[model samples]
Target: MLLLLGLGAWAEKAPAETSRPALTVSVQQVNFVDMERTLSATGNIRPWQDASVSVQTSGLRLKEVFADVGDIVQAGQLLAKFDDTIIRAEIEQTRAAIIQAQASLEQATQNAKRIRRIMGSGAVSQQEADQVLATEKINQAQLSSAQAALVGQEQRLAYTRLLAPYDGVVSAKSAVLGAVYNPGQELFHLIVQNKLQWEASVSSRHLSALEPGTKVLMHVREDLFAEGTVRQQSPALNEQTRQAIVYVDIVPGAQVKAGMFVQGDFKLGTRKVIAVPRQALVLRDGFYYVFVLENNNRVALRKIEIGQSLPNGVEVLAGLVSGEIIVVKGARFLEDGDMVRVALAASETAAGAGSVMSFARAGR
Candidate 1:
C-alpha cells in the first residue's frame, strides 16, 4: 500500500515540473505610427553642369597652365597662356604697314588736288586729271585693307590667354606646355559651381509620383546621408530598359563626389502603418516571424510580411494587427507552444509604483 501511494505522488509532481516556463520576456501591444512612403533607386553621381573649356586658336603653342585638376577657379580668371611671340610680331608688322599706306594716301591726295587745279589751266589735260583721281582712289583702298589686317592680328592676340567661362572646379586638364593645340581641342573640364546631382534610374511605373521639388535622401556612405531635391525628370524612358532618369540636385557637400554609384530614396508621401521593435523579429528558413502571446502565458509563432524599415522598428505590412501582444525582448530563443514568464517592462514597473503611492495617499 505505501509503494502504490508514493508512485502516485511522484507521477503528479512530474507533470507540474514539465510545465515550467521556457524563458522570461517582455511583451507590448503593437501600435500604429506615421511612416513615409519611399521609392528606392540606384544610379551614378554626375555634375549638374559639365562645361568643357577648349582653345579657339590653332597652331599656338601652350606656354603656361595656371589651373590643374581639383582646383577651384572664378569667372574670367586666366587659366592658361599661349606663346604670343609670333602673334606679337605679326601685329607690329600690320601697324607699320598701316602707317606706310597712310603716307602714300596723303601724297596721292595732294597730287589729285594739284591736278584738278591745273585742269583747264593749260598745265594738265582732262584725261591726265582723271588718271590722278583714280590713283588717289587706289591709295584709299590700300589703307583700308591695312587697317583690317591690324584688327585681325589684335583679335588673335586675345585668344592667346585662355580664361575661365564661369566659376567652377577643374576636373580634368589636358593642356601641356610647349605642345601645339588646334581649335576646338578640349583642354579642361569644369563642373559648374562645383555642384553635383544623382542621376537615378527608376522604373517607369513610379514616374508619375516624382516631380520637381520632391525630397530625397541619398546614401553616400555607411551611417551617412545627403539631402537632395528633385530638379527634373527625363521626358522619355529608355526603350530597352523601360526605366527613366530622375535628376536629383544634392545639397552641396563633401560627402558626395562625381561618378560615384550610390543608392537613394525618394519620399513620395506618408501613410499610417503598424510597426514593432526590431528586436521582436526572428528569421527562420528565409521567413520573418514574431512570438504572439496567447492565453495561459503560451507563445504562438506568427509569420509576418514586412515593409519599409524605420529607425527603431520595421513596418508590418501583413499578418499582424494593432493591439496584439507580442514578445518585444528575448524572442529569438522562443518556439511555438512554449510557455514564458512575462516580466513587467521598466515603464510598466514605474507606473505600478506610482499607482501604489497614489492609493496610499488616498487611504491616509
Candidate 2:
C-alpha cells in the first residue's frame, strides 16, 4: 500500500512538471529615435518655362515637318519648312533688278564725268552738264531702293524655315504638311529647356514649414520616390481653395513628364519616437501587443499603440517606454503570464542584439 501511494504521487508530479514548459525567446530593449514628420499633398508636374512658336510671315504653305510631338531638338534646329517657290522667284527678280540698277548707275556716272571734262573745254554746254549730274543722282537713288528691297526679300526667304528657339522637347505640333498658314499663327508648342517642376498645393496652415531648400518627395510611379526641393512658395492663399502653391524643383532624369499629376509630401520637421523590432509586435482582436519580459523571466503581453511603420520595426507612440526589454523574436508563440527562457548563448544573444541595433540605425 505504501508503494502504490508513492507511485500515484509521482504520476501527479510528472503531469504538473509538463504543464508550465518554458519557451525560448530573444528580446531587445526599446530604442528612442528622432523621425521627420511630413505633410502630404498632390500636385501637377509642369515645365519651368513654356513657349509657343509661331509663323512670322504670312501666306505660306508648310512643305515639310522635321519634328513631331515628343521629339527632342536643340536651339536653331529646323522644325518645319515652308514652300519657298514664290519667295525664291521674288528673290531672283529682285537680284535682276539690282543688276539693271547697277548698270544704269555706272553708265550715268561715266556720262557725268565725261560731260564735266568737256564743259571745262567748252565742248559741252553748262545746261547739258547739269542734266547729266541730275541723271546720275536719280540712278543712285534707284539703286539704293532696289538694294533695300533685295535685303527685305532675303530676310523673308530665311523666315521660310521655322527653327526651334531653345533646347526642348516638342510638346505639341500644329503645322500640317501642304497646309497654308497665316502670320503670327502658332506652329508648335514647346517646353523650354525640357525642365520640369512639381507645383504642390499645400494648406496655408502648414505654410511655415515650406521654405526654400525644404526637402520633398514626389511619387512618380508606384513605389518610386523622386527627391526634390522647395524652390518657392506662393505669397498668399488661393482665394478659392484657401491653399498656397509650393513650387518644387525636381532632380533631373526622374521618370516624370510635364502635365502629369503626382502625389508628394514635404518633410516638415522631426520628433522623438520609441520603437521596437517588428517581430516583437502581435495582433489580437484589433489591438497591438508586445511581449514584455518582466522579472523572473516572465512574459507579460502589454497593449501598445503603434504609429508609423518602419523598415525594420514599428514606432511605439504610446503604452511603451524607451529602455524597456521586449521579445524581439518568437514573440508570437508566447502568451501572457508564461515563463520564457531568454536565449543567452553568446552567438544567439549577439544575433538578437545586432538585429535591434541595425533596425535603429536604419530608422535614423
Candidate 3:
C-alpha cells in the first residue's frame, strides 16, 4: 500500500515536470514613430504642349525630308523642303517686272520735267504738259505695285523650306518624297521642348492640400521612379466624378512617354503612429494577427487592423496598445493561449538577479 501511494504521487507530478513550451520567441513592445503620409493618385503622361508643323504655301512637291519621327530639332531647324523650282521662277519674273516699272518711271519723270520747263515758254502745249505729268504719276504707281508683288513672291519662295517653329522632338511625320502638299496641311507633329507632364485625377476633398511646387514621386516601372512638381490644379471639379485634374510637370527622362498611365503619390508631410516590426505580424485568412505576450509566459493571438506601411514595419491601427509585449520572431508557429519560453536578451541575462523574481513568477 505504501509503494502504491508513492507511485501515484510520482505519476501526478511527472506530467507537469515533463511538459515543454510550444516555442521560443523574441518579444518587443509597440511604440510610436514618425512616418510620412501621402495621398495616392493615378494619371497619364502627356506632352506639355503639342504643336503641328504644316505648309503655308500651296501646290509644292516635297523635295526632301530632313527630319523624321523621333528626331530632336532646334528652333528654326529645317524639317523638310519643297521643289521651289516654280517659286524661284515666279520670283525672278516679279523682279524683272519691278525693274521694268522702275525704268518706265524714270523716263516719264525726265519727260515731265522737260515739259514743265517749256510750259511757260509755250514750247509745249498746256494739254501735252498735263498729259506728261499724269503719265509720270501712273508709272510711279506701277512701280509701287510691282515692288509689293515682288515681296509676295519672295515670301512664297521662303515657304518652300519648312522649318521647326520651336525646339522639340518630332512625334509624327506625313511629308513624303514627291508628294505635293497644299497650304495648311500638316507635315509633322512635335512635342514642344520635349517636355512631359502628369495629368492626375484627384478627389475634390484633397485638392485643397495640393498646390504649385508641391513635390511628387511617380512609379514608372517596378524599380524605377521619377520626381515631379505640381504645376497647377483644375479650377473646377468634374460634375460626374467629383474629381479634379492636377497637372504635374515631370523631369524629362527617357523612360517616360506621352499617354503612358502611371501611379504616383503626393507628399503631404509626416505624422506619428504606433508601429511594429514587419516580422511580428502573421497573416491568416485575409486578416493580420500578432501574438501578444500574456502572464506566465503564455501568448494570446489577437487580430489587428493595419494601416500605412513604414520602413521599419507597419502601422497598427487597432487591437494593440503601447507597452504591450508582442512576439517578434517565431510568431507564425504560435497559437492562442500557447505557453512560450521568452528568449532573454544579453542585457536581461546580465541583470539576471533582478529577473529571477519575474522568472519565478513565470514558472508558475
Per residue, candidate 1 scores C-alpha lDDT tens digits across 228-263 of 999999999999999999999999875888999999
Looking at model 3, residue 120 earns an lDDT score of: 89
Clashes of 3: 0
Estimate the overall C-alpha local distance difference test score of candidate 1.
Answer: 0.89
Residue-wise lDDT of candidate 2 within 168-207, one digit each (tens)?
9899998889898888999899988888899999998888
Best by lDDT: 1
Candidate 2, residue 58: lDDT: 77
Better of 1 and 2 by TM-score: 1
Better of 2 and 3 by lDDT: 3
Name every residue pair that clashes in candidate 1.
none
Candidate 3: TM-score?
A: 0.82
lDDT against the true structure, per candidate, is: 0.89, 0.85, 0.88
Per-residue C-alpha lDDT of model 3 across residues 1-364, encoded as one tens digit per residue: 9999999999999888746677766788878889888889999999999989999998888999999899999999999999989878888888898899999999999999889878889788889989999999999999999899888888888999889999999999998899987789999999999999999999999998998998999999999898999999989999999999999999877478898999999998888889988988899999999988888888999999999999889998999898788888778877788888876656766876322111212332
TM-scores of the candidates in the order shown: 0.82, 0.69, 0.82
- Cα RMSD (angstroms) for every candidate in the order listed: 6.2, 7.9, 4.8
